[model samples]
Target chain A: MSTIVVFVEHAAGAPRRGSQEALGAASALGATVVAVLCGNGADAAAAQCGKFGAARAVVLDATAWSPDSAAIGVAALVRAEKASAFLASATSSGRDVAPRVAALLDCTLFSDCTALRKDGEKLVVTRPWLAGKLDATLRSSAPVLCATLRRNMFAVKETGGTAAVSKGPALGPGKAVLEKIEARAGGKLDVAEAPVVVSGGRGLKEAPNFALLEDLASAFGNAAVGASRAVVDAGWRPHSEQVGQTGKTVSPQLYIAVGISGAIQHLAGMKTSKVIVAINKDPEAPIFKLADYGIVGDAFEIVPALAQAVRKIKAQG
Target chain B: MKIIACIKRVPTTDLQPRVAADGKSLDAAGVQYMTSFYDEIAVEEAIKQKEKHGGEVTVLTIGSAEASKEVREALAKGADKGVILVDNAWGGRDPLATAKTLAGKITELGADLVLLGRVGTDRDNASVGPMLAALLGWACVTDVVGLELGDGKGTARREADAGTETYAFALPAVITCQKDLNEPRYAGLKGIMAAKKKPLEESPCPPATSQVEIEKLALPPARKAGRIVGEGAAAVPALIDALRNEAKIL
Candidate 1:
């Protein structure tokens, strides 16, 4: 019988949402889902994985697996278990680790898979190619198949079933060590993790004028700040903050684009957001067609008002 | 020092794309193509590194005949030469196949250092670089924003979700350039003319075996229309009420 191995990703002790999504997908894939936690004190991750429907949770106690050699340890676990399928989240860590694990197993992997199914005896994986412009179905010939699920693509569910927990022996001494981590300047939430994102474009006119976007985002409280390719190319904001086909692909619950005419490349990244709001003076802007809510007016006047209104509501609460 | 930079010619994602009737490929009727934005940065970084370390830069690409134009563009920008890995049979292969083909060519060329874009503009998979490194059994540093190379060793600063991570690796390593790594340069008229004379080599390789295949392609569903509350700061009151009572976000 083939078994499914879901690699658990966590920070400190809290589990990442993408990891839960991977477990959910694994459960649907018809294999006995096994969760593998590689770092020290992984009981929390194991429990969370069980709550999310893993049939069994395996904790591999290895300090070397702590941020630095996590990939090597994951490769080792995948090899030792002889897992037929290995699942990961498509975050930075997953992206870095999945390919290496696949290489170690001498197998092929599909990244950013949105869905999966069994086609006869082979597993057919569905993934967005060409910046989400094309959906491709992939089948692997190797005995071990690997995939990284996109964030928020699958819903997380709790099966309320008890999971069998097991402990595994450590691999060996790791080659890399965890050094210090330095944070970025922005205290705002990351664009990828934010439920709501308010982004600005060149239409905001100048750098300081971005205050309108800041005010609006602050009003939302849970929102993050983002920018278009043009604004970032013009050096109005850092490249890290850019969102487009070339930059970060985000699918926040709500995305508000300000003073922006949606270009195809720009739309590709955020079109998947649950609710879209476009604020632009041009009624015919491409953004209007995609927005769930659109206001055809000057952003300078609309944004400030929106901010104040949001503030008032929050204060009332 | 010798550097090999791998590039791809992708459709300029700025335009809307149409799916063919087969529902598995792009129509490609009027869409324009260009060197991927990240690959441009890779080429520029290679040129800058060559300028600093006194080495030769060779730009390599795997694509159809039209992709040679992108190689010429790289040569025009300052590369010493250009090489095209032409495989008509491998045009529609997956990322792993593409990486294997490129790795074979890179090995044949005897590259000391390999540079690639963090990810291509079209696919956004971010897999080929690491896969190539694994195939070659070479050290790799990905999403690099800063780099320093000397004495057959290198150090790189890579961007992560939490922060920057620094890594040190020996020579014959693979480094994927990110957007913040360097500013790409434009090809001047002189460089464009000089590019015509640069050595352009064409090599054909056998098609790589692919384990993944595409099933279908379709457009994303459209969002429903949303109602506007009012106008200006005065309208803010009603908007707040809507968000609280209607949307429940607040």
Candidate 2:
């Protein structure tokens, strides 16, 4: 059987949910899947890989947060297994790592895959291009293929494969040195990867008015707060909270825009979101044209009531 | 110092992209193009670095003859010169292949610095800059929102999932500009007319080979038409109900 490998994307002390999802997608191909986890104490992460149907889970002693180090480790794994396929979540970090892995193998790396399937000796990947405006089906025939999978596109399930775990080889120091990491704004949840995002804009009128969007995001519990470029430029919010062409690109599961005009720049950042909700008093606001749900009303009255309704619904459970 | 700003001419994304008659590539008829947003930022940043340190900025792109417009835009932004690798070989080339051509050009230029957009809107592959760096055996940083370069070293910052991260690298590094890294200045009439006379070089492109190929292209499933749940605070309960029962995301 051809061996397929999945890279483990880690967070605070553990692999993130997307890591399991990658493994699950690979397993659905009916091939023997090996999950590779690199970094300190990554062995613990391997323990759960078996539950997702991995044939084996291997740990490599690579430095954390270094794509180059992880790619080198994966290169080793590929050589050992002569792996036919590799997969990782298409997160910001994954985007940094997967290409180098492909380059190392002389294979082509495909990104933002919504569907992947194996056909005999080849694999096909479906991806959205130009902001989901179109879909392209890509085929790889390099004997080895590398791809980054989009989040929420696959389901994670327990196959109870019961894989054997072991330690693998590590790579040398990476070229770039990570000097520091600091929180610039918002909180732990980044708008780019958050499952839910609630954003505010100039319509809020003042910095304190942003608290309304915060309340709505708080109601989601897991959502992050975002800001329009106008608000960020006006000093109503930090640049880290800004979402637009010149800001962060996010494709969260749900995105709510409040008191914001939908400039194409801002829409470009979040238009790929699975669900979009827009609230603005201007009936002709361009945001409403793209919103999955829209309400034309003053945010002051509707946001508080919306927050209350969301809280009530969550409390019911 | 010599700086190479690798660039791409991507289609404006606000409108829908149509598949060609072959159903495997983008339709080119009447398609409008501009310098990819991030690459524009890279160009502006490269010019800024040149202003700070004595160096020349050379804008390079692997594209058709039409992409010279993108180069001219970079020239208007203050690049010293421009080169567009024009060849059918570049068509359908994967990120790795694109890196190969770029690395060749950068190497030929005896580069001391390289810059590019983190990702092109068309391919959305934020891979070329780092791939080029790896091929050249140089350090690299991607999605950079902040940067400072001088002497023989550079420092940069970017946002991460948890927070912001800072990195330091030496000269001959490849740095990919993220959006908001710097606001690209507009090309005024004088700058635009000056770009008309700036040297723009074109290189022949040969057929290329890659491990990846596109099989088909199709439109994504259209979003369902939305409905107004209600009006004002009175509609909040209905919206909540729709989210819980219909969308089931909450």
Candidate 3:
């Protein structure tokens, strides 16, 4: 059977959900699924991989490596894994590193794949574009195939695979350095990772209107607040919270877009969210075309109502 | 100093792209083309760098000769020259293949630095700069909003998972521009006239055979039509019900 390697990404001493999602995607490769990890909690991450689908796991302590250098360092370990197909979650770091791995391996790669399956000894992948209006099916002829998978596309289950753990050598000196990192949001509660996102737009009118969204997000508790490019440009929100062609592309379990008119740019960022609910006064709003549920109304009235309902539900449940 | 900027010719974001007669490709007849938005920022940054650092900025693109329109657009905004790389080998090629071709041209030109859009609007992924950097053995940064050039190094601030991070890179770096990096300038009448006088070069860049290929392209399945559960505050209860019971999200 072909050997598949899944890259496990970690943060603050635990495996990130995307890695588990990647591991879940790798399970269907039906190969000897090997998990590879680096950075702060490689050992812990490897152990976590065991519950997903890993048959074997390798660890490399990459404390000093930046995302750019990590690609080079982990690629060295991946070479030893002899992965016929390599998989990673399509996060910022994962997207940054996967192509470098492919370049190091002298093969081509795919990104943001929503699905992958074997086809007569080859693998075919599917990715979306045009704000999910177009889908592209792709194939690679390279001996080793590598892909960055879309978030939450594959579901993980406890498989009790009992992966055998191993250690890899540390990386030597590298050219690129991490330098300094300034985080806009505290606690790593990134909009990209949140299960639910409450996004606001120009329809919200002013910056204070965001407080209503903050209340709704607080009701969802685990949800993050996002902003469309227009509001962000208007200084209604920070760039970190912006979601559109120029901002973070998110795929959450549920996305509630308040007052977003659904420009192609805005839709391009969040169309992948599994369930979308748009609240807009305009019935012709393009967002409704992409939303799973539509509420035709003003945000000032609808959002407060949503907050009240969500608060009551949370209080009771 | 020699600098290269990679630009892409993409359909205007406002236009709705339709499948051509082939049913697998975007219709070309009425698709208005422009320099990919982020790439325009790259070109603008290159111009600012050239003005301050006494260097020439060469805008490079990989597409049909029709990309000349985008090249002139870049030149009008202040690039010194333009080069279009067209190849039958590169038709429908993926990012990795495109990067390899750009790497070859960058090496051939002996570029001191390279700039590209953080992500091209078409195909919309941000991998080309890093892949090309890997091929060239250079430091690479993406989503860069702040940049400062130095004697042999540069500093850049880019968006990260939670926030933005600042990085120091040695020379010969590949830095991709994000929005807000700079205000891309519009071409004035004089600038447009001068752009027509700028040297535009075109060459057939016979890229290596691509390993990855698109098999088919189709309209994504339409999102299901949704009912307007109710109007205002009264509808909020039904919405909550849908979220909690039907969608099971709550």
* A207-251: candidate 2 lDDT, tens digit per residue: 998888888888878888999988987888877778866566677
CAPRI tier for the interface of model 1: acceptable
> Estimated TM-score per prediction?
0.91, 0.93, 0.95
- Writing each residue's lDDT as its tens digit, candidate 1 over A1-317 gives 37888888876675677888888888877778898887688877787677887988888787543332455667777777778899998876778777767766666778888788887667888876666656667677766888988877877878877678788776455332334455766656767667788999988999898988988888878888899999998999877777778777788878889978988888888887877777887878888788766676788988887887777767877
Rank ordering of all candidates by lDDT, starting from the highest: 3, 2, 1
Tens digits of per-residue lDDT for model 3 on A62-170? Answer: 6665656777766776687777888888877787778887887887778888889889878999987654556778888886888888877778767876789888776
Q: Write candidate 1's Cα lDDT for B1-250 as tens digits.
A: 8999999998887767788888877787998999988999889989999999988999998877778899999999999999988877544666677778888888888877889999887767787887788778677777889888999888777777666777767788788899999999999999999999999898886777776666666776555666655544455566556555666656
For candidate 2, what is the DockQ-based docking class? medium
Q: In candidate 3, which residue pairs clash?
A: none
**At residue A215, what lDDT does model 3 achieve?**
88
**Every candidate's lDDT:** 0.79, 0.81, 0.82
DockQ of each: 0.47, 0.62, 0.65
Per-residue alpha-carbon lDDT of model 3 for B87-142, expressed as tens digits? Answer: 64444777777898999889888887899998877777677988899888898887
What residue pairs are clashing in model 1? A137-B213, A137-B214, A137-B215, A138-B213, A292-B226
Instruction: Rank all candidate structures by their DockQ, best first, as comma-separated numbers.
Output: 3, 2, 1
Candidate 1 to truth, TM: 0.91
